[model samples]
Target: MATQDTSTSTQLSPEALEGALAPLTAALGDRLLTPPADGFAETAAVFLGGPERIPVAVARVRTTDEVAAVVAVARDANLPLAVRSGGHSFARHGLADGGLVLDMRLMDGIEIDADAGVGHAQGGVLAGTYSTAAGEHGLATGFGDTGTVGITGLALGGGIGYLSRLHGLTADNLLGAEVVLADGRVVQANADENPDLFWALRGGGGNFGVVTRLDLRLRELPVVTGGMVAWPAEPGTLATVLATLAEAPEKLSGMVNVMTAPPLPMLPAEVHGKPIVMALVCFAGPASEAEAVFAPLRALGTVFDGVSEIPYPEMFVAGGPEGGASADARPGFLGEGVWAPDEAWAAAAIEAVSSAQHGLAVVNLRPMGGAIAGVDPAATAFAHRDAAWMVTVQGMALGLDGVPALREWVASTSGTLGVAGRGYVNFMANATPQDVSDAYPEATLARLREVKRAYDPTNLFAANHNVAP
Candidate 1:
């Protein structure tokens, strides 16, 4: 079990806190978790360990009514509010500092309307669960690579993944949402209803309210040719691959990384723990033409080739690690707007991760063009749709002791690459207030604040990537 980091915070009076939680306890029955309560420690767990702010109480709400009740209780008590879907926030928004956290795990449910080409998922739904459920109907919506991330948080911050090039962002696929506002009012936000709130929720992060359910538009995804091809870490190789991918068809989407290879069956054993540049890709349209389209990338180095035809869920197989036991968090940042790489930064990136003495370490490069750029800049709160690349330098730490060194390495590596300014909201890890502000353009931020003021006037949902009202 993860130990508490109570050193950083003052604990609330147990008697007063419990009294404040009485109504919630009565309403939620056994679902409310208080300190020393059964499953209390487990309720506070998040993907990345060592999170600060142990929640004063955790309410695992299953229904929309339960969500409203929890919100009302938190509001009445004037406690900080944390909204958790899949318990996968890199910033640990799932936990709170003497606050009430609404854990949405019990709400995981995915219902697909095939003929309508849409999927309505409860807040607790994870990417893997939703993908498998929707894939069964031969339909999909792009999300983060990992299967465990909550679709609600992922979509709210603008999800980028293997199918991003073809389908745009996860937020772009959002058709509607059931939201419990700060004052305990439940309403639906979409293009035709509460339109301004809908715009802010797309990429504005979870600053307005707790999203209980999401209506995502799904695309027909039958078969996709996807996998990785690696090369020894050669300077300019990643840039070449990115340039090629920038011009590649919309059906193909992937991520580039410089990592020390692991001894997996798909890769040769000799290359483990050595610098390498690898590209993981998915060609969603035609299986026959995937290899041909990937020819230029293979020629870059081609030490290992695992590309093959597979279902969309198979694309997530061995797709890096996050949450649960995979605590060797790879933390970094992507600056605002589109990036046309400087080429020299690729060398800096490869050199940076090569210095890691132990555990998983790498610099990631995710291409962000194709259909992502096709959206109007002001269309959604995810204002960086025009970015060509989202870059980050992440690596494993030797537990908490190595965090200082790991963070320093990441900072130096990113400084060399110059991916500064606003960052991707989902990638907002340990970001400063100014850094968070940079995530949106001026006009986008202004409009988002307007919506924030209107809905979350007192800013009860300030634990997320807060757009303060």
Candidate 2:
């Protein structure tokens, strides 16, 4: 299991902090946010909640050269380094508890070469931020389902979003990347250049280096029929939706979410706490043909239908309870992939959500197929390419007080489904060392370690879903 970051209570050694400060402040100048600075708190705040980390300093880099310079400073000082892009890691792995954190937030730039249909984006960009901007060009790159997730983590770890089936995982669409290695060397990886590192970067977590920017293949996504449709909890209904989505056209991708309805404006007030099953889908084909494609879904006793022909970025629309804050929050996440779903599996899904003892609980069945499976499993570091159903069980509470029960629930539920060992790199929250290793196949793991040794032999960037050298 991952341990706590003690940087919160213990201050950095003044000499070491001072050592890193001079060159960093000189290179970054006013962009550096150190302790006692007015914006330090705001600069360090991550998504969900507090990382509880008070790093010696946070260097907000606006250029790739600056990223290289800050990296050299940390390297020369022998200080551990962390890379912060969007700060949306559920594990908050974006922050190095006590080390210098390179803030990539200011490098948020998106340039779409419409002629080439390629998107070159900075590491600090958010999924939603990029999606919105890409939508303006009637183009987009697949990312995590949420708008706020950082593109760097989401893409590097293997993004499964609304466009997953239509295109493929975010990493599959990546054409190239510019990475800063442990030795302060900046290199570009692509199909023809540094192919080994390029292979590792696609679906391999941020273990090799600090990625400052990425070049991704953009898709022509002018519109999509996407939204949520909910129903009162029923095992049969759940089975039908999962099966239907599995057999649906490649252009249609979605998630089957089972949980108590949150008090959203559209949902009836009385239904706030009632158990329900919701299917959120996006059809990337012609907008006019979406109704026909989703005809059968409406027949499943729909309680709410918000599907519409909205802009591509609208797929990131969100509602429901605000999850617990990052700090003081202990959440257990277990993910598995199944070939099919049955009534029993659906009932178990419902049970998983309702059994949470505290905070919030969610059970999601992300249907995978189409373009996601078209790529050879061995082509990228991601290996779970064939599973039709990816089941994720999540439980969150206020503190460590609720962790034991949450772990027990996840363990029992995952075991019951007979998928106890499967792991999705992106969604495996609060993961252990073994869990990180298990995210890839045996062969892939060996190759990743080899690449790890080559690029980051000492594992200088060890603050993510780490791949040990």
Task: Give TM-scores for every candidate, taking all chains together and pairing residue i with residue i.
Answer: 0.93, 0.93
Candidates' RMSD to native? 3.4, 2.8
lDDT of 2 by residue, 343-417 (tens): 897898787677766655667778887888889888899877787766677665556566567667666666666
Question: What residue pairs clash in candidate 2, if any at all?
Answer: 49-326
Tell me the deviation in Å of residue 258 in model 2: 1.1
lDDT of each: 0.79, 0.78
Cα deviation in Å at residue 36, candidate 2?
2.9
For every model in order, what is the number of clashing pairs? 3, 1
Q: Model 1 TM-score?
A: 0.93
Off by over 4 Å in 2: 1-12, 319-323, 326-339, 398-404
Q: Clash pairs of candidate 1?
A: 47-323, 338-387, 422-438
Instruction: At residue 323, give the lDDT of candidate 1.
Output: 38
* Regions of model 1 farther than 4 Å from truth: 1-12, 319-343, 357-359
